[model samples]
Target: MRIRFDNTWIADSEQAILLHEPGHYPVAYLPIEHVEEGVLLPTDRITTHRDLGATRWFTVAGPGRRGERAAWTHTDLPEHASVLAGHVAFAWRAMDGFYEEDERILGHAADNYHRVDIRSSSRHLVVRAAGTTIADTTSPVVLYESGFAPHWYVPRTDVDETALTATQTSTFCPCKGIAGYYSVAGIPDAAWFYRDAFPEAARIDDLVSFEPDKIDVFLDGKQLGVEPGQTVIAHGLDRGLQPDEIAHRDDSGLHNTEGQQ
Candidate 1:
């Protein structure tokens, strides 16, 4: 993995270690040797993780760039956590972490839990909001994700596209590329779908699924409430660059919004 911020390559390593914290996606850890010199400035801020001992933060800076509290390292670790010693990891959303010249992922780092197995289903699914049927699909794809409830993805044909107003809200799932949202009536971002799903999740391409918590989802004749692991959480650009920290450059010349070449 390679990390870049403000147009400078700060770190690159073949020894990138992927750490998957429960309830979150995986994060890459690179050996201190792989990081460029004079980039990580120790900060007073310190935090701790459950397994990784006392952690310290750093304001990472590189050629024309500065990310405040953007990097962290586990300073005092238990002996078993020796592998994490002298290694630092950056937040995926805080900085641009790429796998190669064009392989970059956003939101959270990819994890094994990212994979979703899809199977076709004949059971009828109806999505209702504001007393109107937004979708009535007899042909739905059953998506089984590791920690999420089994989702019913209704084909566009069975959905009342007119009732779905596209919203600015979008999220990136490592295995699912970018997901878009749609609003129903007054409900904001009540539905989400993978307009262009990654190859691993191609089965759900263009199929919209309603958030059980945001709207009423019915299977056959029973209502479905929020599932145990269904989260409507949104990912933010957690860290921001300081103005005058770097000159404005044309991002189009080097990277696309999707990082897909």
Candidate 2:
């Protein structure tokens, strides 16, 4: 993984390690040698990773941009986890972004266990929020993603536009493009649709999916229960960063061994 801040390459390495922290999802880590000089300033803040003990924080500065406690390093760890001895991982949301080769890695470093499979379903699907029908369709598209509920995507035509109120809040999925928001009469962000989905997820092009927690979703008259691993966990990196969060850092030359080695 290669990280850039303020347009300056903070670190680039083929040895970057992708870690799955208990509370946090996928996080990218690179060896200290891969980091640029003066980029990481040791900080006072410390955190404890569920598995990795005694994690230390740092202030990563790039050009005029400085992130308080933006990066962390596991200062002490068991011998089995010594591979991360001299490694540092930045907060995906705090840093500008990540990349593999020249392509950007959205959300976080890719997780082998995480995947999205979109399938066409012919079963009758119904969405309701606060006793008001949100959407009903027989041509629903089912998005089966690892660790999430089977999201039933209904065609825009079958949805009742009168019951949906548009909201400005939007989120991005690395698998899907920007997801637009919709609110029901008494619910907040009850539904969401990807107006312009990424090519990989074009199947759900203009279909909308209701949050099962906020609204009731049924398939063929059966109420859909939350899957074993379904969750509403916060994906901070998925929320697009504000312009004020970006800063450039270009200074002393720091070389990297970046290709897949």
* Clash number by candidate, in order: 0, 3
RMSD of each: 5.2, 6.2
| Candidate 2 lDDT, 1-261, residue by residue in tens | 788776678898999877665544676779999999999999887877667899899899988779887888998888878888899988777766677776666655677777889999889998887787878899999998877767889998999889989987777676776788888766889889987576678999888888877789888998886666554355433333332222231112123212210
Could you give candidate 1's per-residue lDDT for residues 66-99 as a string of tens digits?
Answer: 7888888999989987888899987555565445
In lDDT terms, which candidate is top? 2
Where does model 2 exceed 4 Å of error? 44-50, 128-134, 227-229, 232-261
Worst 10 residues of 1 by lDDT: 240-249
Which one wins on TM-score? 2
* TM-score for each candidate, following the candidate numbering: 0.78, 0.79
